[model samples]
Target: MSKANLSDNKMSATCSLSEELMALLPQTKESFKLDFSEKVEKSVVILLHQARELFYEGKMNECLKTSETIRDYSWEKLNTGTWRDVDKEWRRVYSYGCLLKVLCMCFKTDDIGEAIRVCDMGLLMGASILEDILVKVVNVLQKHLQHGKRPETKIEELSKKKTKSDHTLAPAVKLGTAVPILQCPSLEFFRKNYLVPQKPVILEGIANHWPCMKKWSVDYIQEIAGCRTVPVEVGSKYTDEEWSQRLMTVNEFISKYIMNKNDIGYLAQHQLFDQIPELKQDICIPDYCCLGSGEEDDITINAWFGPAGTISPLHQDPQQNFLAQVLGRKYIQLYSPEESESLYPHETQLLHNTSQVDVENPNLIKFPKFTEASYQSCILNPGQILFIPVKYWHYVRALDISFSVSFWWS
Candidate 1:
């Protein structure tokens, strides 16, 4: 069968499970023909058709269920015949990690404390020991996809190759599972990098690539930081009870402000205390939480900076973002919109688009599927940038008294 046919078959197999389960996977808009290269086009075809059918049918429950089960078929077959059981279980443990994650999101939105528990269960499962990252190819592709700007370079040559190339830096370990294929990065180094495409860049040679410095340094930052403006969006409506309760500490920071999201559109302006002056650099951050260009807009840029314990709930940005760190440390667990089956975005209209679990302390019974999610973890230091694609579910922690910048672009 052709590539599109195969992935579609996977989705058809998914539809056979149940209508509710099938409604979970979101459409990518790109065709089974357009997505997945020749290598996985067949698989994409199978996955795509069932996804569309279930979504159309509103079989969210079944869509999530099938997505959970199908994660295994995508694992790379091993050479050791006897190890097959281990392989299957491995996929089950993690694929379910993604599954429970979705279920948890369903509950978190529909029900809450329960979703928090589910998120924790998934984390403990170690199902996602190996994870795939949101790889950003060259800017030309990003520019092309975002605004239909034609590539000055040859698009055909870039399209011809799969993702394994020099610029698209993948993890050090070999990933033996079926990875979703996106166009890899081009050879150009200066004008673009994944960080740049995702947001603006700030190079801090002093803090770039420090392995574990981000673990708990907010107070340290409050004392020694320099004057750099950060975005905040708390509205006039929220009283001190809600605002102070939300933005207070690292832990409270994540819950009320980061993960605890509502449409109040509250904001806070931040100033980092310690930016080494001899370095002669201070960043003028953008308020991307309310992002738009020239005049008309679709998104915004909201921000938080503090010690360990800060958090942001799993929500998708209508537009893409570039998140970079200036000091201390942080961790981000991410899942794309296409992987909604694993993340379990809400079903209830109240929190329909919001993830269900209280990522700070997830409750599991209500959101059993959160236990199955496999997410990409990013550690941002003085200068590293993480390009978070639009609509991906992300859970974040301060790790330390951290100073960071987020750029939201159309």
Candidate 2:
């Protein structure tokens, strides 16, 4: 047979196999829930379909290009607190794209080792939906290596280099002992000592004059916002798959999460002051916010109310924040933007603003850099305001049935 005819037959057979595998997968009526803008999702799906078509046509190079496009887009969308059961369908499609790219690398470029490394990355990203296909790819690559058909890839060379580099750095370094507390510093003093240096400081007596400081108890909050439906975070922390958003009345939130500690639910980041004008009258914005970009109208005031043990993961905000403790105590930790590399920020786009390492109980073996990242910690008391500069990493854990308000300014 002619070489052209032989190649055509092989492509036809491969297309048939691809179709059969896809057919075997179960179908669901539920629509895939991607945790991104609709524009991003649409673009990714288009590229994914293009990659599949190229694969069936036996255009390995074109298939690889299209597959890589999908992979890159997926990585960018992989944000923290966005991964959940609803994303499983999108993840499955992403895994298929990764597998196609691995096949092209192995068969077309003869890079068996690189193909294996790519497979490992896909698996790490919770792409087990294509486990059967990945296993087959790995086995084939292993056979190629055993036969000495391909050269060792760059991944192996990099691994050897990393081993030498790892030994050069110290295993761990301790963070700061404590955060400083200032007793109502003037606007100029605060701007110079804390805001200019981008440091964190707990300011006492800032909210003592606010009526909310004395009036915002569980009973008072329930009485005022009891009937209003508000968004609540229903989990101990935002990182879990079971973590989800719930909308309920303020009274229900107080009864379920605060009154009884059966499960941790939080009325976090809600604009209570805006929603209930009565609440806004109780507190006043500090004069320090005028030191910012001078956009007072653009400032956002948000409320955070939750039971003890509720946690806000290590994350950075785009605006300068003034976190005021109103009714309870909270333990907070802050890391400067300079230590971002040491904090091991997530590579995926979804969690680009958050750290992958758990600040409380860090996995040193997996994230050794976290140990070298120094931080300042404090226990925020009622009537204290914490100044957090833009992009400063902060993690918060309520020590009691805490109620805090945060003002975000430019």
Candidate 3:
């Protein structure tokens, strides 16, 4: 159906949409009452109630303005402290603003594609609230388009540019030490040999069968998830004073940071699979994760996508990690937990897991013992997984434009 048909049948579409979307209001109200009542600022609570009333009265513009006010209030609370200090009340309030804003956009706009983009904006920026109601709404809108119940303007095909760099790939670092490499070892062997002793090993061939090895290219990611919003870390590493985070569409992140490479932007440590489930279909959880806890929900998967030269400063994680390289290569160095004293951990609670010493360029005068700490290094290639035992001090740097998934389990 052509988009022009929408004006003729606009009233019918609007009427039917009211019936469908109005059903979600009661659920939204109940969630807000439960989570926000007597908890958040009075102004926020009042605006939320006002937004709901406006929405029910078909005053979408008023509702949108009220929702923006609520969002602004919540964002102030969010920015008062660091990202770690953002509490559930603030996130819920912010999410409600997004929810209300998306609903208003959907109700007022004739363009379904623009409605989807609004939903994506919320999904990219909002925290997990009300069982991810935004995701639910997006699914519903997408179904309407798929069933041809609503006419949609064509989505222009994004430029499928190759991730070629003008700069030459840096030579792989050689540290005179290497983690043991295992080729598709049996689960039994992996558990008894490596998992039991809490040793790190690079496992090859296990991930070779995954579809991501063949299907995931820079273009493929851009095609599938380009429109999606993501939190990107901007700077060479987080430990730098100038380091900061920004939220941008994946397409913008790719063009501005990933491709250009003048400034580094890393989409690091984000649970992207939960946000975009279609991308999750391209890979499977490693069977080895079953060795720990044996429960599916206990596992945490994060996506690390960035340009060459993006660095993860030396840090230790609390859970065991299976770092899988889906595309490009990375140089990873690991130090045992026993060597923590020599590695010079930061004094602050926030950065206690991170080493004060820069592994690549150490200041031997400030921390003379850091040079004496033993470590293992490897150039992790595509279709390979590196097992990092809990509290294993690891430093990572991308050797090329890279996309890696990490599965962390207890």
Candidate 4:
């Protein structure tokens, strides 16, 4: 959606949405809340990396400023996208805000208590994170306290309260807020037989139903998408898939993805669609498209072939993502929306924490709060379909050589 549309669009219907979102959010807005999707998680990773780099470079002031900016931007972004958990974002901002505040204090040379106080301000903004940060304050003070600078009595009191409350939740019950549990099948068959429910699975039979299937393939996509000029970080790669879902012009997607695909001179995007006027006709699409009903005018696809370590970080699209596995299996770790606290989402909106955290060996220290995450696992087969709901946080990696098609639909 464009900025113009946001202002001119029928926001009257959505005005109440803003208020509802705010109320759902926890008092704390320091952390992020990545629900049954992946985008927000990726955004958080980027912030963590950026913050670490800045801290290491001794640009603490710059880093702090950027954190504040990201916090505000994330809220605005979520506000614009109706798909996000507005309430969760509210709490998330504060949770992460607390983390940033704590980091800021760690770097302060003057008074540790002052730094804790500064971080504690997030309590007013993101109370959950503030609570955690406040608990840590006395410990930090004790570590750096000079002479009798230690407020031992207050610190002990805080420590006792924290110890009283700290407890690992069940695999199902999430930390922080109490909400209803989402029941999912064991899906053991999909997990064990497949690559531990990792690979993207495409239902070839279903492709027969999609209007675009056989008509769109490597040969055809190459004609429409074209062997184009492109840019990348290290290598350039792309993939395509045809599915049979809606009975219409082009089955579903001419989805073109390229490895390390960069912006400038990306011919695959500029030419392919322009060349395929057949694809431009009144594409009715569907109500659940990732880009929604009308935006098919601006869509593209690519293929991936080269890479052992090639990985798409934890993230998600605003649409209902349909991923089909063609050859290899890719391990996927998905967290539900209810596990928002565990994900520690980003403060900004459009940009998710694309950082792919190793869920298996999560650097718990780096993502200390990640221990709060609760997720469902799955592995896609040659014909399996992974229905990734909007905003769910997913971390994926190829278990081996693999091929797949991700239909980013609403």
What is the C-alpha local distance difference test score of candidate 1?
Answer: 0.41
Candidate 3: residue 57 Cα off by (Å): 3.3
Q: Mind giving the per-residue lDDT tens digits that candidate 1 earns over 1-410? A: 99999878755543433233223333332321123335443653466456445534556666655655444444333223444344434433443434434442342233222332333323322233222100011111112121222223332343234112211222222243222221223324312553234422223343333432343233333222211112343432221235432322222332233333232322233221111221113343333333334332433333455434445667776656656676556656666566677566778765566786765457877777776776665555556556576666666665544556565666
TM-score of 4: 0.34
Q: Candidate 3 versus the native: TM-score?
A: 0.82
Q: Which numbered prediction scores highest in lDDT against the true structure? A: 3
Per-residue lDDT of model 4, residues 1-410, tens digit only = 99878665535323333233233334443333323235456666567557645654667687777677656665564556463335554545644645554455455444544544444334323434423543344334334433454222332343344332222221222343222221232345334532233332222343333434335333343333221222222321121122111211111111222212221111212222222334333122322233344365433333332222344556655544655454445556676656666666555654454433555667888788777766666544344445565566676555433345554543
- Order of models, best lDDT first: 3, 2, 4, 1
Candidate 3: clashing pairs of residues: none
Query: All candidates' TM-scores?
Result: 0.35, 0.58, 0.82, 0.34
What are the Cα lDDT values of the candidates?
A: 0.41, 0.71, 0.79, 0.42
User: Deviation in angstroms for 321 in model 2?
Assistant: 0.7
The candidate, 3 or 4, that scores higher on lDDT is 3
**lDDT tens readout by residue for model 2, 311-371:** 8889999999999899777888888999999888779887899888788898999998887
245, model 2: CA deviation in Å? 0.6
Clashes of each: 96, 4, 0, 75
Question: Local error of candidate 4 at 25, Å?
Answer: 58
Q: Candidate 4 local accuracy as lDDT? A: 0.42
